[model samples]
Target: MLHGSDTKYRMFRAALLRGRTWLTPVCALACATVGASWFIADTMVERIAMVGSVLASASTAVFFAVQLAREVNRRNERLLALAGIVETTGDAVVAAKLDRTITAWNSGAENLFGYTAEEMLGQSVQRIVPAGDTTSLQANLDHMLEKDGMHTYEVKRQRKDGSLVDVEITLSPLRDLSGDVVGISSIIRDISERRQFEGEREQLLERERDARRDAEYARSLVEEQNRHLVELDPMKDDFVASVSHELRTPLTSINGYLDLMLEDDEDFPATQRQYLGVVRRNSERLLRLVGDLLFVAQVDAGRISLEMTAVDLTGLVADAVEGVRPVAEEKHLELVADVEPIEIPQADALRLGQVLDNVLSNAVKFTPAEGSVSVRAFLDGTHAVVEVEDTGMGIAPEDQARLFDRFFRTAAAGHMAIPGTGLGLAIAKAIVEGHDGTISLASEPGQGTTVRLELPAQSGSTESARYVETLL
Candidate 1:
């Protein structure tokens, strides 16, 4: 905002005292001659009048030209001021000297480069530009001088803090009135944030692709495991019979012998008893595996029926805890429950009971001797929070992110070979979420793990009426 009164807007020095024109003396002589000849040289008077008129006309024309030039200069000054305001008002304005010195910088440049004009001016342009760009910047300037019009390009510039930023820079070479080359003026815009955001988006896309690849790989592995499962001891007789009709006829063949031996049990040998025991163990393991596979299938298909009923949450916790107490005691681990005295809205009692059983069983399995597993449940506002915290070989940060993923076992979990179908937690998650709940985990390597479940409290029920009890 240069005021009209400001020195910057003042008339140029060239306008100040352009010494009276070279012919001023000649014009004065003409005037004096005309005056002297008025009476004495009447004949010469016409000649003098003619000469005076020509000189006066010439002077008038010169004066008008000077006035016009002055007006044009004033208008140009106003335009320069407006342009300066517009350029500096934005984030980046740069001026480089003919000698490669950074001469002028604007507010936007300050923000982008983290350097004030005082620090940058008079310094070689390389002082702030990255070392790699120094040669390029010099070559650009050389190319600019040879090539005429304004040049626009992008450059990577280094900030005062030594961070790199992408800049959309447009350079225009300055010129004198005679069109002589002067220097360069640039408009720089910081595009670092934009570049970073784009990079992040690309990274997320890569992660998504990797996740899909990993999932496809896992599906192949599961198919292989299903083959192994075909031979393992099974729990459901009908399913086994349905699976392998060839084996069903053979299993019937084995059943006939079992019946014959049991009927004549009086003379069964020790070796035969041992053989039968091995067969029985294999059969049971296979059946359990098959049952898990089927249950998981039902969960996936959303065909599992849930019978909703009113059940005391505290009572359920106690029952699950009591059921697992002996196992925890066998490991010499302490199992503690802190179930609060608040009831929740009506729920599928059996489904929720199974959910508790699965969670506690996992906790006990992972916990070592003398280690503790804590089950804490309470109603907070409109949500029931259940936390199964255990002192065990905790999950790693990278693995914790996918802890709820089906069949996902942490490295620690694999090394220990903890007995699990791996479907327990996944099934628990499906059941809890069916009731609109969220499950989360907080764990650190070697510290412990906490699997927390938050279920929304029944909206309109008298949950506060019944007393809740915890600890089994």
Candidate 2:
């Protein structure tokens, strides 16, 4: 890995040694010729002696001349080889004096700058440099001279066509035989394509940065919106609870007065009594709707308080089946109840009753004429299991997913014109989950519906409604 200068210096020293070796033989021949000249002129010994001294001087001169010629020939051959290399190289090779005057232009330089040697030679090197940027070229030359070494940098150069090209320039100071800096030789390589690619890469990186910033800003906006929703949730629950309470008071008074009026039917006409009955029924429905709203508000506000107790699932299931039996009979639907004694040591009897009532009522209400409703209760390991199945026009798969969502009515119910507030299953789910129980429904379109309720039979497994968090 010898440097350029180091290799050149070594070669020059080796050539000098070889020249001296050849001069030695020539020096011997010159001495012999001088001796022969001196011996053949014995008659004129004084003249021969002076002639011999002159011949000796001549021989010495000829030896020095032959050595100088060999040295000059080797230098010329080296210069020719260097010129060939410079001309054949792919990169531009330019030689210029310290005054920035171009001296040599190789073929590579011609191809790069669209200029011939005749056109560029003796011209200011500034011809190829970008206008008004000659300071950089001068500074580079000054720096190379100061350091006496090669320096490389990137710069823009102008071609003959007025187009600009990015180039990497390596400027090496050329030295004369005395090892003094005489000029600067430059190797120029086209890097326009490389710099263009780098520019595009930089643009892509900048775009990526902008996209990341936009994503972060979007995330911050979402988080801020979520915070506002979190703050407004309590206010929404309070409003619903207040409205339900106000409605319930008026509804209760209306129902009481209607009951008193309906008891004495003789005081009114038959048509008037019929109207009063309708009012009572409508009032009851409204009251029930208000109650559901209040309950839901309580659940939302985390204010549910359960009265836990040891309860028998067997009696509970029987009572729920009986409550829905009249409705099933009205629809001409068969109602069957199968019970086995199953006890839950800890539960809210009121809430458990509410859950059972909701399931059984829905089973009977959705069943068509001549369809059957079956209620089953049994002890399965440590759990009390209750299942209410109905041979009804069953719920669609899509609607089943949202059956326990408050105020979400099924398409089947809407199509059938069935009357409901859509809050029954939701309330039942909240109450069941409060006691650490699970309730599920299985149904397919036109098949049937099955509701399964499983509760822990042990006392310690259940949580009071007040402490429970209803995920629904």
Candidate 3:
């Protein structure tokens, strides 16, 4: 028993079917008349009678036949649309028609092969194949027909520019309603750019391998030369060491002689004595420079040891300011201190004092007449921040990074005719960092430079004056 909705659906299906133009109205009229006949027979005959149901049977058969035809047509339409979409896509679409001719192509195909529809349509599929690969394409087509599905390969393709490119091809068999192979559909992708990039990267790797070999060879040569040159440097260090020792020995004797002559009851003339004093002072400065060089050498040899202890940073600052006072006065610069009475953490007191003296002396030496040098300290969280600010011939930005490198003197210092051994800042940096603190400088060309030292602060008696006698 077909439902009413199912019966109407059958009629609608008949209306849309193929090769059954006359069947729809006939089935509709037949169904209506059969209903009427059944109604009349029940109304008039009253008694049981054999039902004449031929028209109802014919209407039902016609509905089924029409539905089947419509379904076949719909299936065919869907297959056609799927084929069209596949052939018109840009990822290298292609198709062959029942006549063994290339029939469909998309923009991707045209761009990849440089062939137009007018030139390729109705042409044999073999027309697009390179002469060397025609047999291969035919063999692939035969295999696809036998499998009834697809064959895929990565191969070379010839382009319109007479260049060859790598392509990945997928060929599927196209079949007719009877399942007979009528055509082939293919999807292709041009991977030329990716392949080219891979080739270039491989070439770069090869070049890098070659460069590394060359560099290794060059390094070997340099190492050999360095072995030969190693003998020359020891003599120079020995000479600096020996001469420094030689000069300091004689300078010590000269200083002793001057002191003795000054104390003599038959005193030398005052003018002569003053000249001798000047000689002693200049010799002492030269000796100091030599001592600094030796210190650097000792550090390089891993022999300079830091003896750590609680340092009164206030005292160090005050001492440094006092040590530079006469130099500041001679330069007519005001040297001021704004020191906090707070204690800093564990470090070598003598080393910290040298750091302060180096910076304060620099401030005095570089500041112009009537200019000022100031030392200030305060607590910042857990660190004691000491800043030495000066009104001086300021360092340039380009020279700032190299300020702590040994023997690096700036052009500004050279221009100002400042006499320095260029070891003070480097030594100071070593000492500050040795105490597990950080030192940094900030400066501009015409504006003064600020050397900031950040040292971790101590808490109480447990932290203060806890001198452990050891060596670094």
- Count of residue pairs whose backbone atoms collide, per candidate: 11, 0, 0
Sliding window of 10 residues with minimal summed lDDT for model 2: 463-472
Return the number of clashes found in candidate 1: 11
lDDT of each: 0.69, 0.79, 0.72
Could you arrange the candidates by lDDT from highest to lowest?
A: 2, 3, 1
lDDT of 1 at 243: 63
lDDT of 1: 0.69
lDDT for position 60 in model 3: 51
Which number leads on TM-score? 2
What is residue 302's positional error in candidate 3, in angstroms?
4.8
Please list the residue runs of candidate 2 whose C-alpha ends up more than 4 Å from where it truly belongs after superposition.
Answer: 1-95, 102-123, 132-134, 143-148, 265-274, 323-337, 360-374, 388-423, 441-450, 458-472
Q: Which stretches of candidate 1 lie over 4 Å from their true place?
A: 1-285, 458-472
Cand. 1 TM to true fold? 0.42
Query: 1-472, model 3: which lDDT tens digit per residue?
Result: 2344786455444443432332222323443444332211111111112222434444554444444555656766897898777666678888887556887877788888998877888887666666688567767777777777888877787776777779888998877645887888889898888889999999999999999999999999999889877876666666767777787788777777767776772576878878877887887787777777776766655567788777777777777878888887787776667766557657888888888889888877877888888888777888888898887878987888899999999997887788997999998888888788999988877678788999987443434332211111
